[model samples]
Target chain A: NSKVIQTPRYLVKGQGQKAKMRCIPEKGHPVVFWYQQNKNNEFKFLINFQNQEVLQQIDMTEKRFSAECPSNSPCSLEIQSSEAGDSALYLCASSLPTGRQDTQYFGPGTRLLVL
Target chain B: AQSVTQPDARVTVSEGASLQLRCKYSYSGTPYLFWYVQYPRQGLQLLLKYYSGDPVVQGVNGFEAEFSKSNSSFHLRKASVHWSDSAVYFCALNSNAKLTFGKGTKLSVKS
Candidate 1:
């Protein structure tokens, strides 16, 4: 069983409302990644962090999504304004530093519904 | 950019029958491949991963995957599947600490 934990198994928000989710990575893991799994089962990489520093992110994340992993705090991803298209399963994964072959352990994920 | 392709979107097999899920990846250099299974309303569980050395890797729940460099494929297989094995299986590629996942294959096992 993975130790990574995510809060709010489900969330419902209307358009223009802000939606936020939190993730607590596994112990001693420094790398955290966020991914969006759509209804069609396509996964899109949103953003990732190495400890408290941003590693990489896509254009969609740069616009409406903001995420951070502060020291001694649960990492969070927040959407400034929710959209119908934003409804999906947000997954958080954590991994130890092992070059490119790091095996990321995933949380149960937060399923968001935007109406 | 590296990408993964799961040729089959859904596969149905009888309980106690053999199983194989095809996966192909496109990348320039050596590839890191992984097989993950997601139960309904749950997170992805790592079935297996292949980086180097042996081409065949064993995973939990009697699952295994073979990494083929010549064919650019990493396919998952199970000798015998149970009804509980039905779920969505995803094949992914790891590059530069990022993962590129296939759309996933929904496995339905009939009892």
Candidate 2:
């Protein structure tokens, strides 16, 4: 069983519709990361947060993608307007902030399909 | 930038046969390597990781990986393979607190 949990294992949305996914990180973990895996098996690091504060993120996240990890709440990633190109597996991972031993644990992921 | 390369995109082997998956990485600083396996429609599971310690590290399900700093390689090995072991294997490198994964290699185990 995975400690990291992502809701809505599969999602289908129309183009221009909003899509969102939620994740619950492992207990005592302060760092949360979001990655996008495309059909070609390319893993793209989207964003990461440390206790509700954004640590690192890519340029793509700044435009249409938004994410938040609030205290005592499940973290979420939202896309303002869904696009066909946005169809992919959205993975959530959590890890300790410890410098050298930051082994991340991943969730099953939410597979999104935009029509 | 740190990058991981899985030379072989696909590998085929028979059950009970010894298996090896090659991984090469490029990084200017000290390297931290990890191997993760992804079953069909499942989340990635950590097979093993390599830090600053022993060159050979043991993992779950009879999986083991050897870290070679000289060659910039971290290869995964298993003594005997099972059909259940067939899955996509990814090699990753930690760079600036984030993991950079390879294109992944698909393993096919024939009965």
Candidate 3:
């Protein structure tokens, strides 16, 4: 079974409300990635971290999304003000640095509904 | 920029029948290919990945994918699929430490 864990399998928020979810990556994995899956099943890359350092992120992430992976705490992604368009499945994945390509393992994900 | 395209939006196949899902990608440099399967209300599970070596790579549950640099295609295949294989399959390209995913192909297996 995958070890990556995500809290609150489902979340609901009204427009302009703040929404947050957490993730604990698999043991020993240093790379964490966040992705958004819309109802159409289209995936959008949100952000990624390499051992608590931001590696790459999209523009929308800078505006309303805030994420952090502290040393001893679970990584969290928070939307400052939720919009109806923000309703989607948020997936978290972790990968170990392998010298070669790092294969990412994913958690079950958190489904968010913005009303 | 790297992008992936899964031409077929949905595919249906009978149990015990062969299966194939086509994927095409666009990238300037060498590409890393991966196949991921997402069950209902769940995150994606990695089916297989291709970094280097042989063009064909095998994954769990009898799943396999072939990488064709010439055609810029990476297609998933299974000799005989089980009904439990019903799910959405995504084809992704890894570049610059990020993954660009295709829209995904929804597979429905019939008994």
Candidate 4:
């Protein structure tokens, strides 16, 4: 019964404004992931961190987004200088120590609207 | 390269009716497949996953998926669908443990 909690369920940012989303992984989970879902119902993986080290990330994340999972603190995904295209639901997920069989638990997601 | 394809963009089924959502994949071998559901305004929830062993695996919410290696498909099915089954279903393929998701199929269960 893993539960991932996210802060500020809703977010609105103007073009070029910064947007930050936070996620508290389930207790003892060491893997965290960030994804962007658009109106088209397509999900794009942004980045993933194993403990405090990043394991994998997409090109889009490297350009506009930065995510970090500091020791014992909630993981944060920050979008710097958000553009109109950056407006989408950003979802955070966490998984237990197991990599293959562990089902990732997701947060409620932070809906970002960049106007 | 690994990918997941859910051909139907939308599906409507009556309550208590049997349901099947088609999902196909393109990978080198038996890949890690998963079915996830997303209710309105909620993040995705895992319904089931298939890694190995039995080709047919049961998941939460009475959902099950069958893996056919020859057909390269992992279709989701339910014996009797409930009205609360209305949601977007996504099929995912993990290549090298990196998740690749499909454009979800929106399922609407009618009363």
Arranged by TM-score, best first: 1, 2, 3, 4
**Ten contiguous residues with the weakest lDDT in model 4 chain A:** A96-105
Rank by lDDT (best first): 1, 2, 3, 4
Predicted candidate 3 versus true structure: per-residue lDDT over A11-100, tens digit per residue: 999999999999999999998999998998788889999899998889973489999999999999999999999999999999986533
Q: What stretches of model 3 exceed 4 Å from their correct place?
A: A98-100
- The model with the greatest DockQ is 1
Best by lDDT: 1
Model 3 lDDT tens row, B1-111 = 778999999999999999999999999988888999999888889999999899999999999999999999999999999999999999988887778899999999999
User: Which one wins by lDDT: 2 or 4?
Assistant: 2
* Interface root-mean-square deviation (Å) of every model: 0.7, 1.4, 1.9, 1.9
Please, what is the TM-score per model? 0.98, 0.97, 0.97, 0.95
Better DockQ candidate (3, 4)? 3
Docking class of 3: medium
- In angstroms, the error of model 4 at A94 is 1.1
TM-score of chain A of 1: 0.97
> lDDT tens string, model 1, A1-115?
8999999899999999999999999999999999999999989898999999999998873488999999999999999999999999999999998778889999999999999
Off by more than 4 A, model 4: none
Candidate 1 regions with alpha-carbon error over 4 angstroms: none
Better of 1 and 2 by lDDT: 1
